[model samples]
Target chain A: MEFTVQDKGHYTEVAANGRLNMVAAPKLRKVVDEVVNGGGKRIVVNLADTSFMDSSGLGALIGCLKLARQSGGDLRIAAVQPQVTMVLELTSMNRVLTPHATAGEAFGND
Target chain B: MTDILARRTLEEPAAEQAIEDLHVLLEQLWLDAAFVPAPDQMAFTTAVIEAASNVVQHGVPTEGATLLLGVELTVAVERLRAVISEIGAAPLDPVPDLAGPSDLPGPDDDALLEDYDESGRGLSMIRALVTTVTVEREGDTNVWVLSRDSGQG
Candidate 1:
């Protein structure tokens, strides 16, 4: 899995391209942690290219959301593909980390 | 006769690469059995991946030997099935609890959503996705059989 972090003016957009499974779960946490620790508050994880995600990947996203919130910021997800959407809706984490339509619109209203 | 419309199998070291390869194997199986609906395919694929990932992540090697992952996927007219084998692995202690809650976590369970348990969730997710799942120890292998009735919506 490859993760690219682009510092959007209002938020940091992290594009995760590839399967977001156990192998890539920890990397996601690390990327999001770096963003939060570096003071990049509002975050959007772009999952348009993420084709698959297991429970480990879901756990990492939940953990990232908490880490961002605890730092007085917020973490959101955007551009979820079909497989990723299934995992989120199945696990019901979709309620907590609701997927925005697109990365550009993630923190747009805020 | 339970005719298998399509089948794919893989055996390799129980590692991350095995999971990736197993995914490709699934796609190959689907290509031949396009009669199965997308929803069934999506759910079954997710469950299969979860089971395979469990072996790669948690399967203990007996006597410090290398653990191997073996998978057999079959798509029949009525069902989708996968047998994931944990070869050269130690016995699973306190077998998985599959009868756990499969309900969608409600807004009331916000706290539960925050600190999600990765391992346990995989089992629960598998149970929810597939029609039936069973784990058995066969010699030096722990085999997980996941089956989904493709007839359902």
Candidate 2:
């Protein structure tokens, strides 16, 4: 998977493309770490193009969420695909990640 | 013996690259077995990958042996099955707890997330996605068989 980071004024948007499996899980952590370390307070991971995700990927997301929280920032996910959504709902992590319809909508109210 | 409408198989060194290749093979399998419901395909694929990933990440190799990941995916009219094998690997010292967790962690279980074992989640996800999942040692290989009833009518 490839990630692109964009500063969306209020928050930074990191768009992830392709399958987010074990192969891409570590890369995700590296990218999220960069965002948090660079003073990114509110971050949104756009998963509009992420077609698949497994437990490894889900774990990475959870790890990233914790990292952001630890740094006094927040990490949110947006535009989750069906397969990704299934994993999240199955693991019940959806309650924590709470997929947003769009990157712009995440952290919009907060 | 059931008639297989579609089949895909792969045997390679158990590594991260194998997982990437397995993903491609699954996509091709769906093309040949498009009759399977989308939901079935999605769920079965996730279960297979989870099983395969488990092999790559956790399968221990014997002395001077290179572990190999072997996958056999088949689609029948009413079922989808996968045989994920860990070749050239040592026996599971402490066999995995295939029964999975009694109760999955919830959002309120934030403490669980703090020190979560991603590997454990992979096993639990597999159990939830497939109708039946089992692991057995066959000589030098540990075989994971996952079956999901499909053909949603």
Per-model DockQ: 0.72, 0.70
Local accuracy of candidate 1 as per-residue lDDT tens digits, B14-86: 9888988988888888888888999899999999999999999899999978999999998888889999999
Tens digit of per-residue lDDT, candidate 1, span A1-110: 99999988898999999988888999999999999989988999999999889998998998898899899999989999888888888878888888999999988778
Which candidate leads in TM-score?
Answer: 2
| Candidate 2 off by > 4 Å | B100-102, B105-109, B151-153
TM-score per prediction, in order, is 0.95, 0.96
Question: Cα lDDT of model 2 overall?
Answer: 0.91
| lDDT digits (tens) for residues B1-153 of candidate 2 | 999889999999999999999999999999999889999999999999999998898889999999999999999999999999999999997987877553465536576567567887888888888888989999999999999999571
Segments of candidate 1 deviating more than 4 angstroms: B100-109
In terms of lDDT, which candidate is strongest? 2
Taking the true A–B contacts (Cα pairs closer than 8 Å), what share appears in each candidate?
Answer: 0.78, 0.68
